[model samples]
Target: MKPSRLARDAIVLRRAPFSETSQVVDLLTPDDGRLSVLARGSYRDKSTFGGPLDVLTRGVADVQRRKRSELDLLHGFKITQPWRGLRRELTTWLAASHALELVRAFAWPRDREPALFDALAGVLELLDRARERYEIEAYLTSFAGRVLAIAGFVPVLDACVRCGGDVADAKRGWLSLAQGGLLCGSCSTPDRTAIVCSDGVVRLLRRALGGAPDATPGTAWTETVVSEARRAIDLYVEYRLERPLLSRRLLDRAERSPSREPVA
Candidate 1:
């Protein structure tokens, strides 16, 4: 009998040495949300696998699933976007890492999410050419909101979660990560929620609900809006996902110049 063959465009999310000559790769594919594949003899041959397996590369891969969990043998691969330029810039590198980490967190094997995959590809591409920190921040927050929506964690940013009142007037609200979204001023006290959000912050978040990957706060104002939104989205993502993203942490570390304190 012929062995099962899987082929798709994949983004390398996480990769590590499996043995002396092989590697374990976590992939986010348009057809398969997140899957682990082994690249056998990649490190040894350095010809077939080459170096496309590096994290953040966009490429095509041929993988055969196995009963064992360690590594999937690679049959073929073609590098489409090496993102070599991004690797040279630490900020861009960390931003791309955070995006991939989110992909790894929310998506699972055989769960097709073409839009999210494309968003990720676009963001990684942006990181490759990124010139501003604000750009990456906007993209990451918007992409996080979009992915959460795709995974069905769409937060209730528009109205009260309890009484269904318009969130337009509410001065403050609570966000229940387990409950999934905002509790207006009225319902929050009853729930004794863990995290509360200001109305301005919630409105900023509402702007994010539309899933505009390139939309940052207008330039007339300072970056305070962008900064707050980024923190809120980061906290919201941590609430829903498996763990805090390593890339986000790394990006934060990189952005903190020696002369300044880290922005909250």
Candidate 2:
């Protein structure tokens, strides 16, 4: 029996050539979560996919799912938002890539994640307009924080994870990755596996984790605040995921390389 064809709005996450004229594509859809589809003859010049089927392309994917196989057949793709702005800047492009990598890592196939999909779409649209490196970093951090919370890994920032004491008024605290949140001064000891955190960092984390997915904070973050926020989020994510991300390494390399003119 032939499987029924399904169509859904999807964002391309990753793609690779599978054969001389075919490709394997990873996509994130609101209803389907993360999916792998085989696009036959997509490499051909007059392929039915119509436009370039690259990462970050938002489109409607027509897929035919087999009853016993994990890979689905992609009949066609109709592009909606190509996100052309991302191609104009290296930082923004890399930032978007990093976000997609996180989704690919954490999102499960066939899991319903409409909220996660909306959050990702919101962040990508913001990244398209971000002008500074700091803005890009801030947005990426925000995206990570939100996604982590959506995945049930919400970090404790309002109070001590260990003792439940309010640390909102405290001057300093400790971020414990193993404990999955902040620890008050009373609960944090010298031997604890934690990172010393300032009140400012805690506040930033609180906002990032709990703020609306479409909201960008108006606070002006100093280089120190930006660095600390990024470090904290990265460390927490790595600890939870049990490994570092490849896209993060690439992003670090790009940051260290010679500077280029800011994207207009």
Candidate 3:
């Protein structure tokens, strides 16, 4: 009888050496959420993969499912969308890499969330097409914010999270991690760990929480607003996740130096 097998369209999020010839690949799928699969003997003279299973490459995967606790077997992976444009520039590559990292961070193993896959797909397309660093950064920031919002971990912004007072009319508000949202002037405390955001930033944040449809090509945000949003979201994500994203830090350093050459 033919062996039982399945196929999924997936993106290679990460890959690590398994046993010299084999590898373990982490993938994000629209239907399967995240899956870690063992590619046994992929280095052999006759391999079944359609192409080299590189990171950020979207492809169809042939897999064998075993026990939930065990790694799935990657029978073959065939590339469909290489997203080669992502490799042409430094920011674009970093942005795509960062998106993958963020996906892996929030998406649980073998849990399905199609929205997550679509969001990542959208951001990758945006990053690949955008030539401007500013535009790329905007898309990246939007993706990060949307990721937080989609996962239902974002703090409240409409009212003071502490006192439940209206902040809609306020010129600006502070996001208190402790309070789980924005804080009105009366509730703001000096000792609290919080992020200060202007009304413009708040508006953008609000738009972001509803999902990031506005992140499309024709949409726009000022550099200032984008910067503020990026800073706030990065801090909030790091605090919530309990560790900093290494890709984010590398991008930050690269962006600060106008004369410095990009490594990628």
RMSD of each: 4.1, 2.8, 2.6
Residue range 146-218, candidate 1, lDDT tens digits: 7777777778776766778766777676776666678766667767433776666576677666675544534
Taking the tens digit of each residue's C-alpha lDDT, what string does model 3 give over 139-204? 877898789977889778888888899999998889886657888988887627777888888887
- Point out the worst 10-residue segment of candidate 3 by lDDT: 255-264
* Top model number, TM-score: 3
* Model 3 steric clash pairs: none
Those runs of model 2 whose alpha carbons end farther than 4 Å from true positions after fitting are: 1-3, 190-192, 213-217, 261-264
Q: What TM-score would candidate 3 get against the native?
A: 0.91
List clashing residue pairs in candidate 2.
Answer: none
Off by over 4 Å in 3: 1-4, 50-52, 215-220, 258-264
| lDDT winner | 2
Selected candidate, larger TM-score, 2 vs 3: 3
Better of 2 and 3 by lDDT: 2
